[model samples]
Target: MANIIAVVWDFDKTLVDGYMQDPIFEEYNVESKEFWKEVNSLPDKYMKEQGVLVNPDTVYLNQFIRYAKNGTFKGLTNKKLFEFGKKLKFYKGIPDIFEKTKKLIEEDSKYKEYDIKVEHYIVSTGMTQVIKGSSVMPYVEHVWGCELIEGEDKDGAPCISEIGYTIDNTSKTRALFEINKGVHSGDSREGVNANTKIPEEFRRVHFINMVYVADGPSDIPAFSVLNKNGGATFAIYPKGDLRALSQVEQMRVEGRINMYAEADYSEGTMAYMWICNKITEFADRIRKEERDKIAKYAGSQGPKHLVD
Candidate 1:
């Protein structure tokens, strides 16, 4: 039995109150609203002008690179992105919830016996460096997100010249399988893509042992993946934001998520309660499975004689 329980997260509005890049826009004195407007138009603009198709989820990175190259976001490097992470404002009960939920598994003696524990992973479309620098980085087991490669500008100043990696909404499911198979984690394991024949029960983290949390429409692909695979799913909406609330409610109505809550993860909040309960539930099931397996596979006591 895979004794590890995984909690996967999507980082943008799911955790923070706003986009992580807002700090960058602030630092550059650019109108973030207008920048996003252009970003939203890039896919169709490219198709009409350059006969090209682009990923709507990540084409914004290209715009970022363009601005960096043009001196608008002068000397923008991964290091700067890391520094920007400190400026992020997370939702209520953030890293606190992360720590508290993880401790639930530790509270049970059976969980300790089976080495069952919870691990937190962030799979995002945002910059990885920023997340690595966030307050919650210490609690996070791993992060999968967009990346940038640093190179010199014409003046030899450091800048982000190229995109290194990207995890779009759809590709986010690949990160799910990676966590399922223990890729890029402490365990030395193959990519989920490398071995197509691995049985579900044999994966490093089974789907039943996972819980995924995120906020909006961009999370549909990931939510679908977990929902169909027996994993738990949750959605978050900002408080008093009826549009955000309605979005998640519709998703719940459509059976895309097991639950939805406001974006507060602090103690006594809905987000905290639901996530912690799910972790406890998974741990309970895993404890049962491990104990049952030991009895079933321990080789039948060599034909026991009735002594009683």
Candidate 2:
């Protein structure tokens, strides 16, 4: 069996400088801080005013959809969101990390016998359209986020109809399981929530072959799931951001992460080296298991009696 390594990531602060919405908001001449301020405030406002408890993640997606529907931004459409994603800036070595890591494993003679497959996935509360349109999208295998529903208008222009999905803090763990089960969004609608049993040997990806990287406390649930399952969890903080660093440090102290590093992912940086070494370690461990299994099977067979 090929050794598959799943590298799951959190989009926002983990991959980019700020929220992915920053560029989108800027393009529309909207103030990102003020917009997010309202998005953050709506849940409490709704619960107190209407007694309707709303998911905070849903509130943000709804607000964006509302903005798009009202024509607040010129030519606002799913296509536009993807275009904005193309313009979205990334942190130092982001999209490169995907290809570089894959090449490192493939080219190394040590891991040649073991078919090491590196898969990238994004589990975020960010906008799915933007992420799908972003430059890094090509590097990712799948994306789970708040998705926008698009429909055609009388003018044949695409319009935002509603939110198709919402991936919040707590819901992030579901994506991890989906990866473990090798189920994707479009594959089976009921697969994620279905209780169908799958045997251990048939499982696509093992927990020990997974890695999760996120920015802060919002990812705690995912971190816990990965850490508990023998997978690796990495907490990253923005460079020189003392507050972000302090928060990340707290998560480490609480045992929510296996390691913490600066956001710098450039070649030769500590974070990059750390991930490369971890991949190597995981690959080596799997290779050893294969060898041991063969050895045990060979030993189990008794010496053949000589046939006279």
Candidate 3:
């Protein structure tokens, strides 16, 4: 039987467009462009005062999630996040990309020989409800991302709180650790159940075996963890965005990711083909190694018919 290949992805910028900008803002009646303009101005108005360089978008979004958690804004409740989720748009070719990927995996003889089951998962700091509401929800096994604690307002109306949503590395890390416990221990070769806790002593499989797709600094820790440990991280950017592409290259140089690609799904596109080929190649290599190990052990046993 062939080994399983698990493809873990980050939501938003990676799998789909980063909606932190448009629809999300529009849904809440916030001026999208102005919000980003103010976000960009923060470094000069705030961070620079403290002798720090800040990416306003990151700071702004982080703060917004915090404020939303505190109920300072009306209609920005956790449920609203899901309602807003329905309006998100994709860059281009996302739906086709997934369909093509599935076809490629199912048709590849090598994948079939190895019993390779391409299990796709979403690991994000974005809200799970938003992911569930997205079009891709049907294809993925589950989404592991920031979650809200559902409760009620003083008037007994439904309310949402980011009290437990992961917005920072520490929280994100914990969420990742808990969601995919076997990653930390490495011993989950057999498989993992969603609700089961990970056992100690097994480190998660290397990212080389995983094609991690993500965007932004919040994804850095997860990206870095995969890259440093031999897994591959692909930093996705909007098509023709030179600046974001530059950032992806910087991350590559910094050893946070392995490659950069436009979020396109055309045949032979780097993202699709590379991942497809690499998965087959990985399976072949593992097979050869295991065979070699078995051969070595057999040799040590000498002639089976010979009496000891």
By lDDT, the best candidate is: 1
Q: What C-alpha lDDT do the candidate models reach, one value each?
A: 0.89, 0.82, 0.62
C-alpha RMSD values across all candidates? 2.4, 2.7, 5.4
User: Which runs in model 2 stand beyond 4 Å of their true positions?
Assistant: 151-157, 185-194, 300-303, 306-308
Error of 3 at 158 (Å): 2.1
- In model 1, where do residues sit more than 4 Å from their true spots? 190-196, 297-299, 304-308
lDDT tens readout by residue for model 3, 132-187 = 77777666765666666755554555566344644444344443443345532333
Alpha-carbon runs more than 4 Å astray in model 3:
33-80, 152-156, 170-206, 216-218, 290-308
> Model 1, 1-308: lDDT tens per residue?
69898999999999999999999999999999999999999999999999998999999999998888878889999999999999999998888888887788877776899889889999999999999989999889889999999886767788999999999999999888888877777873654452455777778889888999999888999899888889999999999999999989999999989899988998998889899989999998888887788889785677767897
Shift of residue 47 alpha carbon in model 1, Å? 1.2
Top candidate, metric TM-score = 1
- Candidate 2 Cα deviation (angstroms), residue 246: 0.4
Instruction: Work out how many backbone clashes candidate 1 has.
Output: 1
Error of 2 at 104 (Å): 1.7
Residues 9-95 of candidate 2 have per-residue lDDT tens digits of 999999988888888787888988889888899988988899999987668877876676666654677778877888877889988
